[model samples]
Target: MSPSGNQDSAPEGVRLQKVLAAAGVASRRVCEQLIVEGRIRVNGAVVTELGTRIDPESDLVDVDGVAVQLDGTKRYIILNKPRGIVSTMKDEQGRPDLRRYTREWPERLFNVGRLDADTSGLLVLTNDGDLAHVLSHPSFGVTKVYIAKVEGRVSAQTIARLTAGVTLEDGPIAADKARLLSASGEGAGSLVELTLHSGRNRIVRRMMAEVGHPVVELVRRQFGPLHLGTLPVGKARELTKLERGALLTLSRRDAGDDRSAGDELSAGPRSQ
Candidate 1:
């Protein structure tokens, strides 16, 4: 038996194929095929042996270079946050906070990133600190898309300026994409969608104001691979298998595209 494989008929841990199936990677047969083709890695080492066993709670597993979450205690939640709720778990100021969304879950979940009290949309709550760090860290370049209702008509020239880039009091910034969804006839308001990788404080609002359109309201519609997708305001749901895989894959690619998941989490802070 390989050192990473079972020592005897009574294996120490669960079968590698069984674990992958349980995590919804594939059916048992397909998982075994993947292992045979050298596509699966356990604890950063490729294991082709059929009887390999891994501690689901502690072992690191990846399928075709994408991280696979095996630990059941780690909770991942998607919340369609409503306005007036703070992003924090517990507020020192005693204001409305995120605790209500996480109170039912036994695990101590916290928001991955942040949204201001007045701005509301998709917010992730999770107990996985490494996942949170990977998602929120500015240097990872995970893009966020926002829909803003701003004052006055947004002209094409303004849109051009936004996409080309704009300079704020603090520094220069640009939208990865900027377009006017709709503009009211009598300056009622305009809906503009912008995609950017910035996590700067009130960045969208500041950018609009600098471009001569002050924002009346803002809503984040998407973050990285996750979308808000009709999830009702103030409601939360657990991540589906596909969603989890997509996120882990993105995190894996972001961490220099070669290191193990554990190694990426253990490394020092990324350069800004």
Candidate 2:
């Protein structure tokens, strides 16, 4: 949608640079330079006019190629979930759930997908329903990276088996990538990382167990384009500008698949 809703022949909206700065794209002065250099796009059109105005409420903006969220009212959160916290907003069994983390935000934010009670790591919380669905649904090719501490030492053969695919009780599933991180000895515990796009219930644990090594503990380190960097456990924070851009880009890319089926985004290689 091009800039619109002129009031008495005037642009009647916020200045482009100001809107860009407000979106955390850059400082106001730098945003002006970006406008001059034509590094910005509004509604899929390159916008370089210094006097250009836009409706932040309706205009779709992007920096370089990444989509920028113009709505400040929406919340996109990254939570480093700790073990033993159920993924739901409320738990019927009275177990610890995600309600506490969401209580502080005024907007009703729900987790994009889930990390079971015993497993924890990065969980995205957002009020953007469209983007949430794109990130959560496995059909869109959104991948998740999990690091598992298993009961027995993992070997190259086991890693190959994971990538080669395994037959679970539900059906056949394969890891997008698998690697053995560490193994102390022949009988000691092992650290293995597996990347997968499947959303089957407790899939990581079930896959490891199917290979004769049950998961002792598991943590998701990556989800699609986002990663669980050094964020402390059980804490929630707003996504950084770059992080937010990458996530939104992934969502938009997947959303495009409907118009151009068979042109899905690559889930990357078979290694973590």
Candidate 3:
């Protein structure tokens, strides 16, 4: 039965959690939780043990009995998300989600981070889990540039308060950069650009609100080396090769190097 057979016969095996993650069923952490819950089955038998391996090509691996497929290609996309669309892939209330904005995108990519349903601008989507994880982590110190319209005139004192740091319900929060775009009138608001290294929930709004100038409108204009310059609202484009490389370099620098805490201090945004 074995006569000079050279064709490959080895079954390609991968960790059960990785298989579930690659299938977009859930994140690795959530997949581990699912495994602990005995919801994953391999070859018709429920398997709950962590680090369990399965052959993707031969074994009938399923999550809750639904068969899943492995993801072979890594996808990355830059989406110019418009207002009102939720950044998440799915909404439990059956509300319109980011998937609608990405219907034309070829691959099924998840957002790298998130912009609030009300917030809008450049959002990065990708199937590369590692990059997504790295980009979202605070250790990467990916600076996000946001242009905000505030309810009142942004004075030097307000900018000083932001740069000095303000205490929030969660903890003390500070802006890495803050500057007034222009002061309109006595009651009219001013446009300001604020940058921050941390991605706390609704941080810009909360910070400005704390300073007596609540954000009336907010738009994220940049992340790291990526900028939203001249890109019309609701229209997205792919990242340039150089931009991708620069982001990767920043990620590496942030991950492996340890600099003084003061080194992370960002300058206040200049008036433009």
Best by lDDT: 1
Please provide, for model 3 over 1-272, each residue's C-alpha lDDT reduced to its tens digit, 9 standing for 90 to 100: 01112336432346778877876778999999998899975544566788576655444455654445443465556777888888899999887687776677677788888998889888988776666777888777789999998887788888888889999999998899888889887578899899998978999989989998888889999988788878887776666645554554455455642222243224211111
Model 2 agreement with the true structure over 84-107: per-residue lDDT tens digits = 999988889999999899888899
Cα RMSDs of all predictions? Answer: 6.0, 7.3, 16.5
C-alpha TM-score for every candidate: 0.86, 0.88, 0.66
- The positional error of residue 29 in candidate 2, measured at the CA in angstroms, is 2.9
Sort order, TM-score high to low:
2, 1, 3
Error of 2 at 213 (Å): 1.1
* Candidate 3: pairs in clash: none
- Cα lDDT for residue 203, candidate 1: 95
Report the C-alpha lDDT of model 1 over 180-232, residue by residue, as the tens digit: 89998646989999999988999999999999899999999998999999899
TM-score of 1: 0.86
How does model 3 fare in lDDT?
A: 0.73
Q: Model 1: clashing residue pairs?
A: none
Give the clash total for candidate 2: 0
